[model samples]
Target: MRCNVAPHTFRSSPYFHLTRPLTRRSLKSIEDGLINAQHLDDQIPTELAPGNAAVLIPLANVMDVPGILLEVRGKMMRNHSGEVSFPGGRVDATDSSYVEAALRETREELGIGAQDIEILGQIGPPEVNLRGNMVVYPFVGFVHAGSSHSDHTNTVALDEPLPSCDLDAIRRNASQTEVDAVFHLPLSALTSPARLRASMFRGNRPYWAIGVQDLVSDIPASFKGRMKQIEHDDVDDSEIGPGKYGNLEVWGLTGWYLYLLMKKLKLYY
Candidate 1:
């Protein structure tokens, strides 16, 4: 269920000169380097929403490019439509754990099966989205190449970089009302503060809204020219710091969680 954004209309923002060129990182290095991973069983505040949800902070390599996976919610959804968010949904009573719930949602929304995901750990505490009145528990999962699907046993493959991780192979959910688009935002660009901007206003109130433009360039050239990303994104005249950032703004609870992930991973000094 992907909508075509016109080719000539995506806003052209100034690009930041990255100190180093973006390259695929070694998965083993990342796993060994990860710290401050929280326990997945941490409690959730059920009162924050009718039913809390578990979201996957999916990290994978797509077409040889390593990055985090995100989605554009379809406008007709019950909540959080037309927004950028990790793949997830409300936790069902049958769910064994938030980890299970997150993986389940990843399968439903992105068509990736549980065998392809390697659960790293939780990100932090559950985030409360006042706009959606939703409480979401975020978990980090490293997606592996389809050829190396976990036996759900020995995980020796995760000890090294498996170049086969590809999202293009999965069949996308065909329902337009559920997910409009699924794209991976590169981690290298995501780590640099120079490559990101935080808008300070939503309406008249103050907030730290992050706008990430890195993925704009990642979009295939043929389709990027016509998409007015910020238009559907609902960006106002709020300041986005000193330099230009891409129009793919991450606002509300998603923005808050993303900022925390950056700090937790220590992706940048």
Candidate 2:
């Protein structure tokens, strides 16, 4: 397995609020400045791992607020059930490039077509998932829901604390067998220092986690029945609220990648 990147330094910043209300323009400003990950020497080096996979950090303007798109794997999924994640999966043998593999997974998992996504570039310092015995490559891309796309709904997820978007039409293309719900998290919410923290998993391995504070109810019923774990940190985080409760944290590889992405944009709090 490849070595992991050391965690970046976290510092208090008076400049945090200035990035809000994150907009298309502000994110686009740094597009050209980002490191270019794809290359003319395009072999995926799948030899580095027994398996290969890719995921896209989807960027979109949902409800006119620019943010990242995420998903919850179906309850019946073989692994990582009820967890929030980006749309992607294992790289296929026929896949010519990691970019294509990432695009295909997004289309299959979210119904967002390749044509709708403008590939920004690949994300660097690829992750090696020892449990899966594979290398996972991530890419940054922009997604534009066309006029034919379903009407937008309010976003949901701990990253931005949105209720799940339930637009029927927009999800027509998504493979419900694999995906339980879709969410668009505002960049500002993800960058909010109050929502982000460092935590230990199970007991020993320390990882970064984002606190949503939403109850188990914020997620789908299917996920609720299959739920196996609940974790909450932060004294200020509420434990009880009406019929709805909160606290779906993002940790492990997902949290790490989010840190890397947000750090790249100078949005990490």
Candidate 3:
């Protein structure tokens, strides 16, 4: 769908300057380099069922800056229960493709329509297993800042504004069973290495890193080697531990998924 913003508005944004010249070859090179550079995917357990799907990592401009939209599932929901996650679900019979599934789910979950979103290419698909049965497909989409949509039309109402909810609610809602929450990390954080750190979680539990393509440059060489060692290590004796950094606790599939996404996206430091 086309955005309503004027062409002149694009001149002031960094995206226009930074992404305008990205040719197919360069984009492919970046994607291919990520695929070959790490063994993050080796960390996911093979027992999970594979399923086709998609998720929109919604980006909205807030205060002239880009931020992601995330949702805290209702406490009563089954499966992940109240955990944080993007607005997405498994591909269904009516869906045409992964992208279509993501868009449809987003509309259902957030009450945002397809016309409001700007498809800025895919961030590719990352695998996530839910309830030991389904492998999730994730796609990233961007929406301009100052964009607004009405969720009131839907059966459920998302009363909180996306940005305000991120700062006030996401962390507070996290707990053992109802611990699902989602929040957007700034793009600057994705490109910078200064904020990245190697974290050992939950009694020094070792997790298989699956998604590290976006944050590879920020990782230290020593840590990279250690990760490689962990990947090849046997899983028999490993224990789950608390996260070494950040408020996030790394345990179960959730931690593993986070590690994979960060590793694949290279969103460290």
Which candidate ranks first by TM-score, i.e. highest? Answer: 2
TM-score of each: 0.66, 0.69, 0.46
lDDT of 3 by residue, 110-173 (tens): 6556765555444423544433455565555544222433331232223222222233333343
List candidate 2 segments past 4 Å from native: 1-28, 36-50, 147-168, 200-208, 212-218, 226-246
Error of 3 at 190 (Å): 5.5
Against the true structure, what is every candidate's RMSD? 9.4, 8.8, 14.1
Clashing residue pairs in all predictions, respectively, total: 8, 8, 40
Error at 207, model 1, angstroms: 9.7
Candidate models: Cα lDDT each: 0.55, 0.57, 0.41
Candidate 1: minimum summed lDDT over ten consecutive residues — where?
9-18
Q: Please give the RMSD of candidate 1 to the true structure.
A: 9.4
- Model 2, 115: alpha-carbon shift in Å? 0.2
Candidate 1 lDDT, 1-269, residue by residue in tens: 12232222222111211222112234333444444344444444333333778888877767656577777666566565556777888878767777788898888888777887877656666755545565678877777765434442354443343454545554344234566667766655554455444432333322334455455334323223324535333443321111123355655556556655554555432
Per-residue CA lDDT of candidate 2, range 134-212, in tens?
7778888777556221221222221332122233444566778887777666665564556655554333434356664
Poorest lDDT segment (10 consecutive residues) of candidate 2: 235-244
